[model samples]
Target: MNRQNKISPFLIIVACGLVLLYLHGCTRVRPLPGPAKPPTKAPAKKTEKPRPYKVMGKWYQPLPHARGFKQKGIASWYGKKFHGRKTSNGEIYNMYGVTAAHKTLPLGTYVRVRNLKNNKKIDVRINDRGPFVRGRIIDLSYGAAKKMGIVGAGTAPVEVTALGRPMAGKSAAATVPAYMPVDFYSGNFTIQVGAFSNPDNAEKLKRKLSRIYKNAHVVNDLHEKTAPFKVRVGACSTLDQAAKYETRLIQNGFPDAFIIAE
Candidate 1:
């Protein structure tokens, strides 16, 4: 009987120990509430219409509404110096690509250029602004110039007609404008040595050039209040004379020098 009593006490002690262990295991540590999520940022709104911009003292208004624009005037080509540079439209210029610059056309416009002298046609996308010189209506890329057979002559009389809006993310096709060609005004001949935003810098260049050339001066932009100051030499009587002077300027380290008709 005494042995039975001792075994019962030992069984009771074992049961109590198991119960304590079970209670301890049932108590779980809940992970602290996760950190609050961060707030999301709103997406930026996109601009649909481009704003007017000024360059070299001239304000160029982008024509987003004008379609089927057609004009006839002198067309010039730019190469090497502008290759790989950022165009007015924020695109990297590729001289070999079929692209052109128009002073007032909206960026991403497609146009058809036909060289009247050679009867060659080329379709180019407008991705920049230029031909800032008077009387020039368009500036073609090296590839476009070569395709239209104007590389040899440097400049040619051409008909430029706007095609529809450029095909988004794809190559644009040439389209003929239904409207008649509009004639552009012709300007007098001058040799542009340089264009500067600062009048002081322009004056400095003009003074420096005056030492070599008798007729050197700074011309303020007629349209804009604070536009580019143009340093030009020679109010040459004819385009041929201006061209000869341009050649001389180019030979004398002014590679960007070109004839501008004012």
Candidate 2:
């Protein structure tokens, strides 16, 4: 009986090892998580596209590109009359913004306008449609006009030069010129060769041009008493055809020939 009651040393060591393994397994627990991360949000995208619209019973389409575009004409500005209104681009008109209105320029084109009277120069972004009167070309915001000293005169003769599209970001837009996209819409078109206030002279030009081309006519604006009668040549089905006629007219004699939508 005394020999059976005594335990082996190997058995005692094995029992102690099993007890330790059980305790180690019981103590093992999942690790605690750290701080949570904030959820991220995505940015909103803005789209710019060319759209045709009508004003005063007339239709106008924006140009696809302003590359190498230059014009000399009357420039006017709007203050309270058009301020707070929606521009052609869908942006609110801010009289204080360095922006402008052009009848045919692309909505986002950047142009340099110089006042011929004072030689004051200002860079403006085209964002709206214009000084719709015949002789006028562009309409400026109050701030732009002020910068160019045209606010006091109400109107000024100016030279506008296309600077092309700006860079991707607003900060770098003025410094870098980007891509020039051409989006031409082909339809019935003509080239205006000359304009005269006197109907007789306009008729004379029309008769002379009619002998050379199948379609040559005088367009007289009946609404405006002071508006000039315009003499145009050729009847083109596409803008490309009108452009070809424009080149021919320019080469022949008419240096001021330009395409006009019919």
Candidate 3:
């Protein structure tokens, strides 16, 4: 073997070391990614406020909840004259649907209306606001009225019990009665002694009640030309106190007095 022809081991080892160092300098050693930071939490939504509306010269505030609500009053209905008209809740009036209109209950509320005359009962979803005539509690569709025996008489005494919004069924299926728990949480309660078409009359009643009550105020729409003024008294924090207050009011002189949510 010619010794000059063979490369020296030292040179070969040096060349290999240089090549490894060059490769190391050229190649990037990427670090393993660190644990991902926890995702940021999303902001929560805000609670919405209830909307109040006016009808037939009166301002009506919708109830926040329908728990433990009961009312006794006249119930009437409408048909062909308003068959395709849009209701207060923005639904097209269907006279044949098992729906009703109420002055203050929430638009999506479900109620059990009992005809006091014949004890006939029907469940109706409150999809509109109406029956603004004094002493009337609810206005039913022609179909609902007929089911509860209210169509022939034109009007009937009814005991309306609030059943709240449906829990297991869609509100669109109002024709098929759904029984769900009423979700009425007690809040501020007051006695509505009277509601008058005249502002002066409401003020007079308020003044009279202020003599014997702690808080007697007139809820009015003085800005509106046709809105009726309501005289409410006794700002009780609970429903029981309001019931007692209403009883006292009825006994004192206001026979038409009723309990109302504030």
Highest lDDT model number: 3
Error of 1 at 126 (Å): 0.3
Q: Give lDDT tens digits, candidate 1, residues 1-262.
A: 4555355788999999999999888896777999998888788886454445566765444543434468899999999999999998899999999999998776776688999998898778889998899999999999999999889989999998876564445434435423222212222567777778889999999989999987898888765456468888988655457668888998999877766655
TM-score of 1: 0.48
TM-score of each: 0.48, 0.52, 0.62
Q: Which sections of candidate 3 miss by over 4 Å? A: 4-45, 51-59, 117-119, 168-182, 189-235, 239-262
Q: After superposition, how far is residue 240 of candidate 1 from its true place, in Å?
A: 32
- How do the residues 1-262 of candidate 3 rate in per-residue lDDT, one tens digit apiece? 6657888899999999999999998896889999999999888886443545555545455666667889998999999999999998899999999899998788888889999999999888899888888888899999999999878889999999998776664654655655556545467777777878888988998888898998999887455456469889988776668779888988998877777665
Q: What is the C-alpha RMSD of each candidate to the true structure, in Å?
A: 14.1, 12.9, 6.4
Better of 1 and 3 by lDDT: 3
lDDT score, candidate 3, position 232 = 91
Scored by lDDT, model 2 comes in at 0.80
Please tell me which model should have the higher TM-score, number 1 or number 3.
Answer: 3
Q: Write candidate 2's Cα lDDT for 62-157 as tens digits.
A: 555445677899999998988899998899999999999998887777788999999999888889888788899999999999999989889999
